[model samples]
Target: MAAIPKTHRRVVLVRRPPGEPAETDFRVEEVPVPEPRHGEVLVKVLYLSLDPYQRGRMRDAASYAPAVGLNEVMTGGTVGEVVASHNPRFKAGDIVEDRLGWQEYAIGGGPNLRIVDATVAPISTANGVLGMPGMTAYFGLLDVGQPKPGETIIVSAASGAVGQVVGQIGKIMGCRVVGIAGGAKKCGFVTGELGFDACLDYKAETDLDAALRTACPHGIDVYFDNVGGEISDAVLRNINTFGRVALCGSISQYNAATPPMGPRLMGTFVGKRVTARGFIVTDFAERYAPARRQMGEWIRSGRLKYREDVVEGIDKAPRAFIGMLRGENFGKMLVKLA
Candidate 1:
């Protein structure tokens, strides 16, 4: 094993941007690595997960989770190897996953910490396909969307971390999956590689509503909403009766200075009896074991596929995160910290 470092670099939230966040909002500083006192382990972070939900944490507002206080390490999921341990549950060399923030070293063995099986898949997957995003995609589509076989399911932001997984799961469930992405390349990847039934390029299409109607001739039965705003309005407008919508993140409006005016579609929802539910992945934590097993089986048999967009060095996390919010990442956004 490599000798532990005395100091490590970490990114801290310095400013809370009311609109789009700038790289200057964060401060990268070197700090002394803390020693684990009791039932804790010191982990050498290998990969940091940059996700859309982290944007919500930047605000000092009431939310499902607490805001990331100014000057604190930015909150994020991390996959790392334990280099020192004061806990019996975890030992040196154990690969683990936890919300250890955007740092090269972090204290693990917290309530949220879990041992990652590096043998099953790459340790990075502990922050992706085998982690929170994967769980979010599974329960959101299967539980919230409640897609039935032969049903037509449409996914928005169809190339993002959660969106990509949701669309592929829809296909595995025997549904006709259609994806709505920003460009032709993303649209092509989803349809050509991920096995989505069809993909519509929202940027290229002048009339999304018309495009949706043509792609989903029978009308959308289930909608996995990742990017909300005008895109969601278009999908909701073309939804079939008794349609289900899994309300995930709304990346399109995350950076808005003020909430965008809604399209007032409650009347349509009432007439059609549409069911829409918002979810956080942890809600289904108890069922993760079985769900993970199934997802693993699908992955092994080539029924499931995943893509990652990784940037090297912790110093680059701020830039990568900003790009991710701008829809620049082609797949799951990750930072290689080691």
Candidate 2:
């Protein structure tokens, strides 16, 4: 075995931000590597996922999950190789996935950690397409949105990690998939590359409602919402009767100091009879095995395509995360820790 280092680098949440987080909110510090206790394994993180949800974790407020306490390692999903072990289920050199936070190494295992097979896919995928984002897309779309053939599906943040998968899955279900992306470049990728029927550039569009109405002539039947600001208002206005909406991430509102209010859409909901529900990926944890198996099959067969926008090092995580919140990342944003 390679010699274990006595110290490692970690990014800690120094202070909760009032609004969109600045780089100063996080500080990189070198700390002594923790030794594994009984039934634990020490892992050297290789890839750390930078997601918009982590932005919500920065605030000291009530949320679905606990906030990252001041001066603690910023929580995140990671894929790493076990370098030392005191547990039988995991051992030296075993690649595994865990919520190990934004650190070079971590010491914990058991129920929260699962061994990953690199042969099935690249280990980095444990944080991206074949991981949380993928699972979120699968359940949120098929189970909640329940798209049907010839129906129209509109996805916000369409070039993003979960959005891309949600759009593709809508296509496979024989729905007319229309994506709402930031710029012309991303819009082109959504329609030209990912096979979406049409993509609207939200940044360029002067009247979003007209654009949506033009693109989705039949009206939106399934709205896979990733962003929840003005974009949602436009989509809600055009929802067909009996439409279903899967409320996923709200990246547009994540960085706000005060909750941004829009026109109440209760009338639309009542008139359309829209079914809207919010969900987290872990909400469907018990069924992950089968869902992952099917996603893996689609990936292997080339039916489901994915993209990754990976930054080079752990120190870049803060900037990458901020960029993601600003709609900068093209796909899954990750920091390569190795």
Best by TM-score: 1
TM-score of each: 0.99, 0.98
Kindly list the per-residue Cα lDDT of model 2 for residues 224-288, writing each as its tens digit: 99999999999999999999999998889988889789999988799778899998999999998
What is candidate 2's local distance difference test score? 0.92
Candidate 1 runs further than 4 Å off = none
Clash pairs, model 1 backbone: none
Candidate 1 lDDT (Cα, whole model)? 0.94
Against the true structure, candidate 2 reaches a TM-score of: 0.98
Give the per-residue lDDT digits (tens) of candidate 1, residues 255-331.
99997997999899999999989999889999998988888888888888999999999999999999999999999
Task: Name the best candidate (by lDDT).
Answer: 1
Q: What is the lDDT of residue 241 in candidate 1?
A: 99
The Cα error of candidate 2 at residue 142, in Å, is 0.8
